[model samples]
Target: MRGNRGAHRGSPDSGSVTDVVVVGGGQAGLAVGYHLRRQGLDFVILDAEAGPGGAWQHMWASLRLFSPADHSSLPGRLMPIQSGHTYPDAAHVVDYLADYEKRYDLPVQHGTRAEAVHRDGDRLLVEADSGAWRAKAVISAAGTWSRPFVPALPGRGVFAGRQLHTVNYRRPADFAGQRVIVVGGGNSGAQIAADLALDGDVDVTWTTQRPPRFLADDIDGRALFDAATARRRALDAGRDDTGGVASLGDIVAVPPVREARDSGRLKASPMFERLDRDGVRWADGTRASADAVIWCTGFRPALTHLAPLGLRGRRGHITTVGTRAADEPRLHLLGYGDWTGPASATLIGVGRPARDAAREIADLLDA
Candidate 1:
């Protein structure tokens, strides 16, 4: 509906405007950009990062994808794989994302952080660090990296030991020779626990609300993604197809985890009742002197930018029909996970929702 206004970087006082403003430069935003490019929509992608490779650049050094490069790619291009590399590390993913942005010539403005989104008559106003953007529609793909969620426990603040979330964890070397507790039942907790246990000198204990479930050795992220896709398709077709499928939450027994299991270091304890001044206290009144705690809890969607619109529900999520916001048709949310779209948070899974959102926005503007 709007003509192309070639890329430029400056303050919002310049009156920068577009038909669509995609509020992130990560996989979901990039995927949506690809479709918008095909639709010939005038749009700009805003990224807060200093350069390419959105949040992937912040991942832990030892972290690796559970799937191969090809299976973990975005919509248009295949993520190139190096010879003999089964699972790509964070650096590889970062490189691929950077290349994807360049290859598509996506109009992405770096260092532009969206602070708020509100309706201004027929247009949506995005207030960002660089300035303001008045867009016909706004796609909020800001993602969950900024909103790490750590559940509260009794005496949490009284514990003398150091506490950090997975967001701050980079490598196992930092906890060397320390008695550490890794908390969470998810894959992150399993991976981090295994990594820390690899160091013979580090005493690592794992705590989970429930026992962690590990998928069979043959199953990895690829299989999990495929199964999720199939289940979604089946549901759309009015059939239940998840009878025997393993959830994405189940841990894939990557090499390190398998090694940890064989070494009997993969064991996890029931979650401690409370944190004590010196350590953690169990239900049976037993206390372990932990030097540090690592919370592998997941993240909440980073939707603060949309608060001004007053669209959030009780769960802090805006209700969406597919990727389009239920309350605000001109506003769409991407990569906020299952509520927005199935597997929307993963690299390979975001493409479908991105495509759908782009098409929906295109239709709305064309009308």
Candidate 2:
């Protein structure tokens, strides 16, 4: 703590007392590790998952990245081209991440879930299931996948049929022969609904609070991330800020989604007001029967591990400057979403902010 990145392997009981301890060994964590290794900081990455891949391993089977393999890689490495596919699917991503970790040899302790972070004298203590580590700086890359969010809709409890989220969905066959209502306007909602419509025997309805927004077919994660970068540059330079990715649209028309839309199978209805025991009712005196409701509503940050720091605002977000927590300079949050950095949630975009966070930590520790 006193001498900066003068880090060494530590006492047996307390784990490694390193210059930095990074939480979550996903794309963001690995990205941070790449830059931190460049800085030659002695650091360890703690990952909750049992192996490489992070949240990608748990995603629904039909999930696919909007960009091709070359366009959707982390820093210092290109994801090997997945053969026989234009867009990489979740399984391909898992394999790429596994290989990336091996190639870089980043120090990641898999299966170690961080429980809490507490200040200890001049250093910060990260307590995890495997052991505790005291470090000069801590980077919370613990991503949002563990914290899937669902709205508190009225009469939701009484719904008799299954209620699930995108996390619970695997493939279309799981919902075959059922009336499935997919909620939310985001990509997951669209993808899941389309999955059922195109691949399964399920009768599916897509619902959004407002009309769904789909980007032009040519637009993918690569183009969207570039737009986000340009918007951030304009804002930083005090120019009339151009719009970010949201201005483009919500859904990126990956092939299956494109097919569903072009075939008129992916039609979105207005969101229902409340749920009955076996169905949902619209505010407009309309009712429909449903076998199940899947809420693809998205997630909140998995920052409960950092709760002891007392930094989150009323809305459960840590106020950030660049990637560093505004209230706690020793702490940096990455990969939660745009709040941490524009497009940082995307596979390609997280690298820039991860690089920035690593540099800031290196400088802070050197100070």
Candidate 3:
């Protein structure tokens, strides 16, 4: 993964009994941090990265928010208005986050990567690379991208060329004048291939196991909203319904990759069966040549250190909508499950739950 600790003030070391310790410094983590600050609670944000912007700063340089600025700003801050009413790029987001941290004088402990969080008697013990902390509670804002999920295809290491995940992607020039096979048709693969094609240097080919069902607008909004509401109601009534969050295809608008495909820029191919010195082999016996393969496959929750928290359901994701483990009350999860209303993993959606979580944490500290 690509990260930058650039231009920081100091190292993150523990010195006090922080009321609550946040385990990440991304948009979600910062949201909870800001709220806890307003509550005048003794807290600190622990980020594995050395700087801000979380994963956004590490995205390909050409990346921009799919949602408009009006739909993506964090709490108490406005996204910078630009001409032409276009979406902001990666750098723009990084700058906005930096400004947010500075404006609020958010007491963030940067460069302190959380190692483990466990209960110690009546308090929580937060261990990090730099130091350890004692807190009354912990906000698990480590995000869905905490761990990059690289699938095990036969002969991955046998391929004799550069291989990179979207998380490691930086700029198009790195692969300039090369034939690239980008795996996965998610937003990242589509956008990255589009940007590379636009750069007029890299020839891009994309692959996906199955084409996602795309929407032009929020056409599927009603059905997806109904599903989320149903799940939320069941949870609120103290029932555990594992299918709270709608699938990605259900919520996100179709990525702009179709435009590239129509223009004959990005060639869509079947999923990879195996990799070799020449290129990728498909299930249909088709072979393609490439110099690099970008795996935009996706990520999983990095809860290795948190295995003791007892996450239920499949993939270790919290099964209950908007509810922490009844057994692990000290573990408050942000961006874990889908909420029926304005509370989802999206930046716009994360606010209400973040507030609710911050208050819950505050109460735990008060006790």
TM for every model, in the order presented, reads 0.95, 0.96, 0.83
CA-RMSD of model 3:
5.9
A best-first ranking of the candidates according to their TM-score comes to 2, 1, 3
Q: Which runs in model 2 stand beyond 4 Å of their true positions?
A: 1-12
Q: Judged by lDDT, which candidate is best?
A: 2
Q: What is the alpha-carbon RMSD of candidate 2 to the true structure?
A: 1.9
Look at candidate 2 and give me any clashing residue pairs: none
- lDDT per prediction? 0.88, 0.89, 0.70
Q: Give residue 57's error in model 1 in angstroms.
A: 0.9
Q: Candidate 1 residues 258-302, lDDT tens each?
A: 899889988989999999888999999988899999999999999
For 279-305, candidate 2 gives per-residue lDDT tens digits of 999999798889999999999899999
- Candidate 1 versus the native: TM-score? 0.95
* C-alpha positional error of residue 333 in candidate 2 after TM-score superposition, expressed in Å: 0.8
Clashing pairs in 3: none
Better of 1 and 3 by TM-score: 1
lDDT minimum window of 10 residues, candidate 3 = 1-10
